[model samples]
Target: MPALVRAGTAQQWPQALAVPGGVARLSLGPAAERPVVHAGDIPVLVLGDAIEWTAIVGIPLAAPVGEAEVTVQAAPTAPARRVAYRVAAKQYREQRLTVAPRTVDLAPEDLARHERERAHQQHVMATFSTPLPEGLQMRQPVPGRRSSSFGLRRVFNGQARNPHSGMDIAAATGTPVAAPLAGRVIDVGDYFFNGGTVWLDHGGGLLSMYCHLSRMDCQVGDVLRTGDAFCRVGATGRVTGPHLHWGVMLNRTMVDPALFLPA
Candidate 1:
């Protein structure tokens, strides 16, 4: 089993950016044990312990620019209390691309495949485990120029779709991708939109995903340390070129991956 983080000395928390698609770190005060926290119905990642507890929340990109609250309970039978925070608006740039018409408008078979993949991926994303003892900071998985930023409103073939939910790193085909943090490989598969994909559970409702890979070296249940090479970059899915789509998810919401890295 992974070690538990010492209450106040070891962990390096992610920067708190209280905006849509950002992270909000709220203090939960001191308690005898780690508090149970939730943002609406989604379980949240809580760190620290008796000395001090903190709730790390991932604000969704579509969240309104206003106040939000989380419910916290020190114990199972303890009354839940609300902690409120503000989510500011952020304007991300837009990107337009011309991809194959087939990818933009999927056929019936492809649509069905996509729906199945989506359901499976959702289950994978919902995984939560014991909180990792190590710090929350992460290194870059693959060194390269950032081809695309997160939250970019994307338009393909003149049809607008969901905002870009991850950072795309420009790397050559077969460029090795590393694990940004120590984690357990929870899922690995080829998908309709994400292509060759790998999901890593970093524990405590924190997860990271790598997509558009040429190859995957790790399998489900593989434990990897930080900087372990686990895959290679590629243009496997509905992409214009070879790149890595790196996503960091907290509490089942995809937030800005940059918040976990050094500035």
Candidate 2:
């Protein structure tokens, strides 16, 4: 697919919520589709009628079944599809669910300022050109059932918030966090939601993040081998317990980690 096209703000997604994964997909039959991720985000562009794309954001697993809005804007030439989704949160054997306390309070502007962060994330997608590291492999940083459902809506401490940005691996405090792949550390610090976070640049615009670390080992610019000790997982930012929150961004778009691993 081409990487650029006439971009426009899609006014809305009327039926975007009915899909199983809270995602809507559009498959362009047989034409090359151009995609632009705003800053450091990935833009999922489906090309060809047989290639429908899926758009999904996670909702809280504990949330009572409900409805939410999705914003979309595209043209007939670049038409968009809307899908509504039904959600049910499951707990026990494999996973658990609950509310996470906020690490801090955000004023309206402090929260809205993230649009720039989101846009910048998308823009990073346009510059992807690095190769993945050699001899790079990964083991689960923490061992536990998933907690925060990926792409789900979340209400932190009673205030509505953005969808969960990463996958939650519920482990005990100080669970060793390892590098999924070999890469140079580019960013390491506390984020608004990702407390004590670190970003690994596995070539190109591909990156992975480890958050809520109770103990951070490597610093920015450190080159690491796969499975290298990166940090110690914990519920540092806002949480009920110690767990490792792992996030991966491919060309800046957040894709399921399972896609890159054995299920």
Local distance difference test values of all predictions, in order: 0.89, 0.53
Q: What's each prediction's TM-score? A: 0.94, 0.56
**Model 1 regions lying over 4 Å from their true place:** 1-12, 131-133
Candidate 1, position 104, lDDT: 87
lDDT of 1 by residue, 135-217 (tens): 79889999999999999999999999999999999999999999999999999999988999999999988999999999999
* Model 2 lDDT tens row, 185-230: 8767765556677778776455678888888888877988877888
TM-score of 1: 0.94
Candidate 1: clashing pairs of residues: none
lDDT of 2: 0.53
The backbone clash count of each candidate, in order, is 0, 51
**Judged by lDDT against the true structure, how good is candidate 1?**
0.89
